[model samples]
Target: ILHPISVLEEEDDEAVIEKYSGSCLAGVSPKLPPLPPKILVEKVAPAPVLLSMEDEEVVRAVVSGSIPSYSLE
Candidate 1:
């Protein structure tokens, strides 16, 4: 489920650029079903690694109320 939110503060007369890079409506063509757009050309990039000696301590601190709500998770 997705919802789109637009700002109403901008006037309606303002022009907006709508460039369609074949992302949203690329794969629904009946004739082009076999050759759909190559949305992803390669495998997804790996996630960044979190490294720190106090990583476990930080989590424990958050769970034990030793830190504030936005401290760590």
Candidate 2:
């Protein structure tokens, strides 16, 4: 005995469902105005030079007082 073979009737029978189970996303930063050249310059005071106990106390006192101003001001 022989049984009839079943066939798919759709025209695009070869089209298979591709399941992508993952996130598709991207990050976008706001369009910011052009920054000044010096904006990126971090004004870090130079590391204090190693000094003797007396000198360290003096230097600490100096830094604790008013910050020095440039003559350009």
Candidate 3:
């Protein structure tokens, strides 16, 4: 046995949008103006420093002490 085949019709698609979604749409934006003065004068400070210290070098000094040297005094 045999069966029949189907086919589709074709034409110019220049007006597909107008037929489905109506006419075209568009938008626009405004321009920007100049800004006013914000500052009058400027002053900047200096940076700081940090140090790690040892107590014997800055506060006191050790010459020699092992076996009762202070008893001689």
Best by lDDT: 1
Candidate 3 clashing pairs? none
Residue-wise C-alpha lDDT for candidate 1, range 33-73, written one tens digit per residue: 46666686777889998858697777777788998867443
Candidate 2, lDDT over the whole model: 0.52
lDDT of 2 by residue, 1-73 (tens): 2233344466232432222212333354678999777656678998978789986766666677643434214
The estimated TM-scores of all candidates read 0.28, 0.23, 0.25
Q: Give the lowest summed-lDDT range of ten residues in model 2.
A: 15-24
Clashes of 3: 0
TM-score preference between candidates 2 and 3, better one: 3
Each prediction's RMSD to truth: 19.2, 17.3, 17.8
Stretches of model 1 off by over 4 angstroms after superposition: 1-36, 71-73
Candidate 1 lDDT for residue 27: 56
Ranking by lDDT: 1, 2, 3
Instruction: List candidate 2 segments past 4 Å from native.
Output: 1-49, 66-73
Candidate 1's error at 20, in angstroms?
A: 39
lDDT of each: 0.59, 0.52, 0.44
Which lDDT value does model 2 have at 72? 17
Among all candidates shown, the one with the greatest TM-score: 1
